[model samples]
Target chain A: MTVKINTAEQAASLIDKYDTFLFDCDGVIWVGNELLPSVKETIELLQSKNKKLIFVSNNSTKSRIEYIEKLLKLNINNIKLEQIINSAYSTAIYINEVLKLNKDKKIWVLGQNGITSELQNFGYETLTLDDIKDKELTMENINNLIDLNVGCVVVGLDFQLTYLKLCITLQYLLNKDIPFIATNIDSTFPFKNTKLPGAGSVVEIASFSSNRKPDAICGKPNPGMMDSILSHHKLNKDKTIMVGDRLNTDMKFGSVNDIDTLLVLTGIELESTVSNGHPDVTYYADKLGDLYALGSK
Target chain B: MTVKINTAEQAASLIDKYDTFLFDCDGVIWVGNELLPSVKETIELLQSKNKKLIFVSNNSTKSRIEYIEKLLKLNINNIKLEQIINSAYSTAIYINEVLKLNKDKKIWVLGQNGITSELQNFGYETLTLDDIKDKELTMENINNLIDLNVGCVVVGLDFQLTYLKLCITLQYLLNKDIPFIATNIDSTFPFKNTKLPGAGSVVEIASFSSNRKPDAICGKPNPGMMDSILSHHKLNKDKTIMVGDRLNTDMKFGSVNDIDTLLVLTGIELESTVSNGHPDVTYYADKLGDLYALGSK
Candidate 1:
């Protein structure tokens, strides 16, 4: 059962227990353009106590810089860009540091600008959907396709995903044993009061056609995303807690990494759902603002 | 072990064994624009013997009429529209017959003209990718969404698939327990001397986002395609044989329905691969034209 940290004393005790708080952005802090109440104050409280704050998100569509801009708009300011880690950034880190992908080899990215920029930032050669589309490559010329320079294929949420893009991605995946990476397979994105297909949809299309599984998924619930953060900062895992609205991605990410989790009901999950699926969660709150109870004590 | 029907006597004996012959088009009879040698004469010979001919294909990009035109071009003439069954038509039949979807209920089709025409033919109010694209539905207008007339979501090979179309299709599939039908989940389609992502790729995108398996796949190896034909023509199952180049879909379709299957080498399968996966195939021929040995006998 999830321990309800409702009283100000209990919340304060829980807050005192952790040295760092890793937050899931969309659900825990804000829902779209509107910021949730008390989020700014709670973060300020944690910062005043010298607790490290990390914003980890699965949204691969935006770069860390863009995410920071959005955060400033929500008034959750004073965070360094280094503390913001999205899936796009995490994927690049995994490729560069873990996979040791050659700087000369290119990644055939089935995603938008964020992934392209991140791969380029890591000094890895990158090819975007536009690169594949601009060439007008089809089956007739596909056989004569000599430039198999791609070392990896990364699939993420692409609004411009096309059949031709998938075909090229499939060819690289099927013809070679190159690494296949997906940022995250989060099925849906809560978009503007409705859900839309996310990166998982694009990954599924390529995986189904190529008949291969992704070698690594650099996102929540996968230790890879947290591994990048944990390795970058020598933080004590025992004193850190992951706060998120979703049990599967956020809470599972925490549990998988041997960190305690706090389930917030302000996102995709409910209280009952957390209890049913993720009994490992250490605490429950209606929203991240409810954690304001912690500072009162 | 696959019994090789090499000699005229062996081929002739096999031909005489079946009263009806269900043919898989792409690999069995033709490879591309070029007709496989002896296929025309062998098919004619089968016709002369008064054997019922049925063409069953998982390719849904083409309508029955268009397929007939292609068949005539290949010189395998005399196949009527009704004798032809493709995944698109089978999906429409499944929706109209098995699902008994109300006439008032519309289907949002993520496919080309083939599926759109078939659904319209069945008198189901239909919306195509073009319809979704024309409206330019986005996340802003998604929540107050008024149009919810869709009762089913049918996915197939769509060259013009867009993100907006996938979003709309996902909405219909997720918001309600609507029938999710896919024409075929064939990973890739042979196109212009190379393979392109097929209907399965499109379906995978929707299925992954919605986190739901298709309620029915109206294509090969599922027996739904064969069921459409069997119920329509009242064909004798015992005396029927399915001939195809691919083992998984065609041979599996035959074996699953208790019909004998003849493996051909002109398309995807080789004599070796067929033996490995489907030893249930009763006979093997190098090509459909190789069945001219039957006529010689």
Candidate 2:
């Protein structure tokens, strides 16, 4: 079906007609610790309309608990903990489901405490850099660890990296031919006011060293994450729209899921940049306040 | 020009008449310190015939002094310290003669102690990894250290690899668009009892990371190294033959330098494996003793 809209006013009316609202946190809500001026107002207005709102972010560094605490501190009202979808949480769910289906296997995690803790919580024996710190990092160590015993490798962000860790992980991956699952593909992270290597760097290095690309990426704007978001909200493609600042990740999510994306220029991505990228973004707004103005009419 | 030989005996007779002998150590003399039998006897026989000999290895890890010491310890010949030619020495000479021809620009090395020492001996100011260990390994560090101020990056073997070192070195090389001179492309090194990542691994990673391959390879099979060997020994390609086990590295040396290569099956590469490889071997010998048989005939 065609997107039934004639004006910015019609667009606003159509957005309000949906009971479910999905919002991207980074560009739309705030950039870093600073909150966008109209983000709270937009969320509160959606809540007043009895719309079920979900805050989704591709950033996997922080847990949902951390996000909820930050959101509450920002004075955004009428939001529940369950309404937050994060790459970390989705990654946890994926690991849990895979383990349930497979039944007998250990998972080796190449991430920080959050991923390890989540895997451990799911009753799967999780291995992290800390676990292998005492062991010599070598091909032999990898061969001993990987051979037909371990199930899969889950890659995430590890700030304190070493050649030994990378070498061992790469050798194990290449030798055993194990499947790799990454949390997300954000190449760099905004850390301490500087862009630093993130999980994507590890993924890129591992892929290069092993000569094998990742088997699966569990975060947005991958179809698996979008499917989980849609299924959890009981939303249909025609009834939903993706709203985000970044064109590649957010706009891509909408286009891939067959939902329209409203590109907001106030965040990491600009309208001019997304204009040429696909799937093409449906609309562009200067700010989140402009989106609120649509519903006002 | 046509490698005129009607039989193996004719090939043996031509090898016997050659007065100056050039030998490649890796996949020729020994592979990771397991000596090829008859290598000692062949060298002794060549010495008895008053033939000038040079034991050249593309391995940049050890200096000539170290190679001479190792060869002496292995009981491999009546050879002088100057008879051993290593890639580190060749790299130093290249930096001094080619890269630092202006005699003003300082050369910074991203390699082992041997390379730095060689460069210093050649009257070039060399900065070792120790000089930049404390600096943040970023593109900025590379820019700061290696702008138009630096001449070239001489890549060799470094055991203690850090991301910062790799990042800075790569950034500097890419930023300045400077020529990179690699010692060799051996992917792995046979360590004491296990295999370790070699210079080629670092080169491959840095090349992939920066999206730029090395500008020049100063080591083995390259015409520069082979030419150096030929000039130092005053050898005739028509009469001389390169007897080494590895086809790609050793045999390529002969082809690039217009000499003949006698493939020996006692070391790293097998004849069956390299049948389709470059510089199709002029002769195949199971061991170095087979070459002595040629000389004897």
Candidate 3:
């Protein structure tokens, strides 16, 4: 399809027709601590038009409250706590739902503080590798431990990845047919000024060694994350547009769920690099300024 | 398709109709160095019927002379050098043909002594990582070096694999977009009674790092190896039956080239594993002794 007009009237008309406007945090509203020039104006315009606004980010390191605080600091105040969707929040909901079905199950988590705290808050017993330091670890020992108590493996990004951890995880999964769940499947994470292997890389290594794929990924691109957001906010899919720069993650969410996508060429994926053009992208813009132009009309 | 069985009388009747009987060396006669019982008898029997027997192996690690020596030790004597079809020979021929078409070209050979020597014999100048050892090495310098005078990259199992070698090769390939040809795709190699990562593993790493698959894999499971065998020996595909045990490699060879395959259970792949069955295997035998049952008619 043709790239829609960059005028404010056309964008406003599209926005008015759709109930939910999902904005990608990075590249759309802000890039690292700096907000885009028209991000606040565009959000205000959408609010005035009686449209629901939600910021969806695949970055699982931050929580909803963290994102809201960041946004409020950028002068985009009046943002509700429920308006942010992060992979970690989706993962927390997934764990809670799974725990509700199986009331007495223990989960071994491989993530940062936010993930462990969230799982514990859901009344599930959570253990880390550090918690079992005294145990003699082998693939067989790990399998026996998992067979006895561990219900499911909950994996997230961990900066201090070790060979011992990978070995133990792979052995346990391989010996006993254990199902694994990951927060996201992003191969790399943008850390400081360079790229580092993310949580997905750990999942990939374990999956490759054991020949078992993750049971479910509770993150972006998967409908689970989007569905969690929509269900939480009582938002309809018919009136939702997913705005992101990456096609595989952002556009995939829109395409899989039949939501409109607004592809902005301001993030990780460059315009010239996206060869497999998605049919879901209803609008294309160079920056958030073009989006504000649509809001004015 | 129903497996067609030609009785001894039928075989004897049609034995004179065919001139050359091209035999696959691996599973037909032996698994590695161990000879199959009645393999000699079968060859003698075929020769008694005035048929020419030629042995073809996709394993390029050994030269035609080496194969002749191995066959001679197994009591199959006086086999001509021209009867052999191997990737090493084919690689030499490919480099010669390419060089004939384009005279001024340098090739980086990432393989063993066999392939390197063969390519050198074909009048093409071959370079290895050792050739660049004297030069100052850095990622930038190595990348710049790869951009100079590189024509083609030929890959095979290199025992002396290093990170520096891999980085340089990948850099040259990514920068220049040079054509890559792999000698084989066997992921694991049977060595000293243990399986080690073979040529396919290195090829996979290079492919993953550069995001470009080999231009052509000049070995097993590809039509190139089979076609070279058929064309060089002047054998028709209809009469040629590839006898091998492995389903993925040997059976895949017959499947792609429309040749019949005889699955012998004495090798790497077992008979029970062939239950799901490939369309390529026209016949199955527990061992060479079972073939004598057809001869008894």
Using TM-score, give the best candidate's number: 1
- Candidate 2's residue-wise lDDT over A160-191, tens digit each? 55556665566457654567778777665553
Summarize candidate 1's per-residue lDDT along B111-170 as a digit string, tens digits: 988898888988988886555543536556665443578889899988777777788788
Error of 1 at A193 (Å): 3.3
RMSD of each: 3.7, 5.4, 7.7
All models: lDDT? Answer: 0.83, 0.67, 0.67
Model 2 docking grade: incorrect
Winner on lDDT between 1 and 3 is 1
Q: Name the better of 1 and 3 by TM-score.
A: 1
DockQ scores of the candidates: 0.66, 0.21, 0.05
Give candidate 1's fnat, 2 decimals.
0.81
lDDT at residue A223 of model 1 (Cα atoms):
81
- TM-scores of the models, in the order given: 0.86, 0.75, 0.61
Q: Positional deviation of B163 in candidate 2, in angstroms?
A: 4.4
- Shares of reference contacts reproduced by the candidates, in order, are 0.81, 0.06, 0.00
- Looking at model 3, residue A48 earns an lDDT score of 82
Candidate 2: tens digits of C-alpha lDDT, residues B159-270: 6655556655654565545667776666665643444556666666555545566766667777656655555556677777777777778777877777777777777765
- Considering the two chains of model 1, state its CAPRI-style docking category: medium
Considering summed lDDT, which 10 consecutive residues are worst modelled in model 3 chain A? Answer: A138-147
RMSD of candidate 3 to true structure, Å = 7.7
- What digit string (tens of lDDT, one per residue) describes model 3 on residues B119-179? 7776777788777655775433543446367678877767565444555566556654577
